[model samples]
Target chain A: MAKGSLRINEISNAANVLLNVIFILLSFLCIYPILLVIGTSFAEETYLNVVGYKAFPKVISLDAYKYVLSNAKPITNAYIVTIITTLTGTVLSTLMIALYAYAIVQQGFKYRRFFTFFIFFTMLFNGGIVPWYIVCTQVLKIQNTLIALVWPYLINAWYVMVMKTFYNTTVPSAIIEAAKIDGASELKTFFRIVFPIAIPGLATIALFMTLRYWNDWYLPFMLTSDPKLSNIQMYLKRILNNLQELLNSSSAAMQAGSMLAVVPREGARMAICALAVGPIVLAYPFFQRFFVKGLTIGSVKG
Target chain B: MVKTVVKQLKDKAIEIKKKKSFFKDLHDNREYLLMIVPGVLQLILFNYLPLFGLILAFKTVDYSKGFFNMDWNGFKNFEFLFKNPDVFTVLRNTLGYNLIFIVTGAIVPVAVAVGLSLLKNKTGARAYQSFMFLPYFLSWIIVSYLVFGIFDYRLGIFNNIISGVFGREAVNWYQSPRYWPTILVLLHIWKTFGYNSIIYFAAIMGIDSELYEAASIDGAGVWKQVLVITIPSIKPVIVMLAILAVGKILNADFGMFYNVPMGSGALMPVTNVLDTFVYNALKINGDIAMATAAGFFQSVVGFVLVLVTNHIVNRIDSAQALF
Candidate 1:
C-alpha cells in the first residue's frame, strides 16, 4: 500500500512539472509574435528581408520610425479622436448605466418588471443594419462625423445588468440606510456613497469601453467617408488595403512607397495596440485584487 | 352637515385611497424596479430601435425612394438569397467552422484552466495567466499581420526554417484551403483560452478546499481529487457557459475570419462564413435588403437556439436555466 501511494505521488508530481513547463512555453508563444512585430518594425527593411523576424534584429534602423513619424499627422489626429471618444464615451455611458441600474435596484420603482422585460427582450432580437444605418445617417444625420462612433455604442444593456448585479451584491443595505438617516437625498446617496464603492466594478466596464473605442474600425469604415475623421485602426486598415492595391497596380515608385509604408505598418500597429492597451494593462494590476472580489460578489449570486 | 361639504369630503377620500395604493406598490418593489431601468433604456435605443429597421430587409431599396418610400418586395430579397448556389456553401462553412470552434473552444480553455490551477507557485501562475492573456488584447488586424509574418511565403519564418533546411518548396499558406481550418482553430484557441480560463479558474477557486483535504486523507492523489471534487463542483458553470455558447452557434466571429483571411480568394473555401458571406455579397451587389435578410435569419436562428437550450437546461436543472 505504501509503495502504491508513493508511485501515485510520483506520477502526480511528474504531471505537475510537465504542466508548468508547457504552460510557460505556451505563454512565450503568445508573447513572441507581438515582440516580433516590434522587433521587425525597428529593423531595417533590407535586414528584415535577409534575416527575417527575430527576437533581435540583425541591423537596427529607425527608417520605419522616421517614415511613420513624418507621416504622423494623421495618426496623431486619430489618437486624439480615439482618446476623446473613449474618455467621454466611457464616462457618459458609465454614469447613465449606473443611474439606470440604481433605479432598477430600487424596489419601489413603478415600472421595474416592465422595464426588465423590455431590456431582456432586446437581447433576443434586433433589426438588421439597414434600419440602424438609415436611422443614424438619415434621421440622426451623424454621417462622416465622430459622433457616429460615439453615439451608437454609448450604452450597452449587458453592461448595465452587470453594474446592477454589482450594486445589488456589494452595496449593503445598512450603508444606504445610514445615509438615509443622515438626511442624504436620493441623488446624493447615489453619487456620493454608492459611486465610490462601485469604482472597481466601474473600472472593469471602463476597461471594456476603452478597448471597444480603441479597436473600433467598422464604425468609422461604414459611417465616415472623410479621411480626417478616421480612427487609428481604420487608418491602418486603409494603409494596408492601399498597399495591396498598390501591389496590384504594378507601379514601381508606388511599390517603393508601399514598401516604405510597410515600415510603419507593423510598428504602428504594435504601437497603437500598445498605446491603446497600455493604460488598461497598467491599471489592471491595481484592480486585480478588487476584480476577484467583485467577480465573486457579482457572479456567485447570479 | 351641508351637502357641499359632504360632497367635497367624499372626493378627498377617493384621492387619498388612490395615493395610498400607489405608495404601497412603490414601497413593496422599488429596488428591483430601479435595478432594471438603465439596461432597459439602452436596449430600447440600441437594440429595439434597430429592430424596428427590420423593415428594410423586405424593401427593394432605391436612393431616390428614401428609406420608408422603397418598394415592398415581400420575400423577394430572401428568395434571392436562397437562390444563389453559393448561399448554401457559405451557410455550411459558417455552421461547420462555428461548430468546430464551439467544441474545441469549450474543451481547450477548461483544460488550460485546470492546468493553471494545479501550479503550486502563485507568482508563476500569475505571470503565466497575464502572458497568455496578452494575445486576447490584440485586434484581429494586428493578429492578421502577425500571422503574415509567420506564413508570408517569401520571408515567413516557416518557409525560412523549413525550405532553407530541407531544400523543399515553401508552402503558400494563404492559398491552401486544407490547412486554414486548423490554423484558424489554433488561432482562436490561442487568442481566447486565457480570457475564458478566468471563469473556470474562478469556479475552481470557489470549490471547497475541505473537499480536497478530505480526498487527500482518503489517500487519493491530485488527479483523483480533481476528477472527484473539482470537476463536479464547477460542472454547473461549465454547463452554463456551454449552453450560452450554443445559443449563438449560428453567429461567426466576423472580424477574425474577415481580417485573418484578408480577402485571399484561394482560401475562401475554408475561411468564408455566413457573416463574411453577407459582407462580401453586400460589397458586390450593394444589396442592403439581402444582407438584412441574412442578418434576420442569423438573429432568428440564434434566438430560437437560446430559447431551446434554456428550455432543456430548465428541464434538467431549474437553477441552470439562464432566464
Candidate 2:
C-alpha cells in the first residue's frame, strides 16, 4: 500500500511539473512580444536601417525616444488632456455613484426598488451608438471638446450598482443610526462616517474609471477632430492612422511623404507605444487587488 | 402601536413625530434625495436622451437641420444598408468571427485557469499570472504596435525568423486577407484569454477543496479529480460567460478588427465587422443615416438575444442568470 501510494505521488508530481512547464512557456510568449517592442524602441534608427528590427538589438540608443519627445507640444498637450479628464471624471463619477448607492441602501428609503431598477435596467439595454453620438453632438453639443472624453463614461450604471451592493452589505446599520442620534445630517454622515470606510470601494471603482478613460480611443475618434483635444491613446492612434495611410498608398510620393511625416519612423512609433503603455503597467501592481475584486464582484453577481 | 406611542412618549409632539406620515418621511430625507440628483440627471441625459435620438435611424440626417429636425425617410436607411452588395459579406464576417470567438472564448480561458489552478508552485503561479495579465492592461493602440513589431514586412521579427533562420519567403502579413482571420483570432486570444482566465481562476478557487480531498481518498487521480470535481464546479461560470457572449454576438471588437491589421484595405473583406462597418459607412459613403440604421439593427438583435439567453439561463439556474 505504501509503495502504491508513492507511485501515485510520483505520477501526480510529474503531471504537475509538465503543467508548470507549459504555463512558463505561455507566460514567456505573452511577455516576450512587449519586450521586443521596448527593445526596438531603444534601438538606434541607424541600426534599424542597418539590420532592421530584431527582438534584441546589437546597438541601443535613445534617439527613438528623443525623436518622439522632440516635439513637446502635441505629446505634452495630450498628457495634460488625459490627466485632467481622468482625474475629473474619476472623482465626480465616484462621488455621484457613491451618494446614489448610499441613498438606495438607507433602510427607510421608500424608493429603493424603484431607484435600483432605474439604474439596473440601463445595463440590459441601450440606444445604439448613433443615437448616443447624436445626443452628445446635437443636444449636449460636446463634440470636439475635452468634455467629450469625460462625459460618456462619467456614470457607468454597473459601477453604481457595484457601489450600491458594496454599501448595502458592508456598511453596518448601527453606525448610521449612531450618526443620526448624534445629530449628523445625512450628507454629513455620508461624508464623515460612511465615505471614510468606503474608500476601498471608491478606490476600486476609481481604478476602473481611470483605466476606461486612459485606454479609450473610440470617443475621440468619433467626437473630436482637434488633435490637442484627444487623449494620449487617441493621439497615438492618429499617428498610427497616418502610418497606415503611408503603408497602404500606392503612390511613391505619399509613401515618401509619410516616411518624413514623423509617424512612420518605426523606432519613434514604438517609443510612442512604450510611453503610452508604461505608466499603466507601473500602476498595475498597486491596483491589482482592486481589479480582481471589482471585476469578480461585478460580473459574477450580475 | 398607537397606544405605545401615546402612553410612552415624554413629549406629546414626539408622538406625532414617531407616527410618521408619508410627506413627513419625504420631507425629513430631502437632503439625501438631493444628494442623488446628479446621478439621476446623468442617467437621464446620457442614457434616456440617446433613446429619444434613436429616431435618427428613420431620418435622413441633414447637418443644417440636425438630428430631430431631419426629414423622415421611413425605412430607407435600413434598406440602403441591407441592399448594398457588400452587406452579405459584412454580415457573414461579423457573425462568423463572433461564432469563432464564442467557442475560443469559452475554452481557452477556462483551460488556462484550470492549468494555473493545478500548479503547486505558488510563487511561480503568481509570477506567471502577472506576465499573463499584463497584456490585458495594454490599450489596443499599443497592441497594434506590438502586432506591427511581429508582422511588419521589412522590420518584423516574424519575417526575420522566417527568412533568416528557415530561409522562408517573407509574407506581407497585413496585405493578405486569407491569413487575417487566423491572425485576428490569435490576437484576440492572446490579448483577452489571460484576463478572462482570472475570472475562471477565482471560480476554481471558490470550489470546495474538500470535494477534491474526498475524491483523492476514493482512489481518483489528478486528471480524474479535475474531470470529476473541478470542471463541474466551474461549469456554471463557463456557462454564464458563454451566454453573456451570445448576447453580444452581433457586436465585433472594433479595435481588434480595425487597428491590429493596420486597416490594410485588403484585410477589410475579412475584418469589416458590424462596428467597423458603421465606421466605414461614415468614411466611404458619408452616409450617417445608413450607419444609424446599422447601429439600430445591431442593438435590436443584441437586446433580443440577451432576453432570450437570460430567459433560458433563468430556467436552468435561477441564481446564475443575469437579471
Q: Highest DockQ among the candidates is held by which one?
A: 2
TM-score, cand. 2 vs. native: 0.89
Poorest 10 consecutive residues by lDDT, candidate 1 chain B: B31-40
Task: Give one digit per residue, the lDDT tens place, for model 1 in A13-107.
Answer: 67768988999899999888777666666677666767666556778767655555544566678788877877888877777777777776765
- Docking level for model 2: acceptable
Tens digits of per-residue lDDT, candidate 2, A16-110, equal 89988998888988888788888888887777865667668888877666656655567778888889988998888888888988998887677
lDDT of 1 by residue, B1-323 (tens): 69889999988998899899888777655554454445455566667777766776788867687767889989998998899778887888888877887888778878887787777655777778878877776777677767877887877778888788788988988888899888998999889887777777777877767667667778998888778877887778777777778877777888788888778999988887878877766656677767878877877788889899989999999887778
DockQ list for all candidates: 0.36, 0.40
* Candidate 1 residue spans exceeding 4 A from truth: A1-11, A244-301, B1-41, B63-69
Provide TM-scores for the models.
0.87, 0.89
lDDT of 2 by residue, B92-165 (tens): 99999899999999889889887877777767777777778878888898899888888889988888888878
lDDT of 2: 0.80
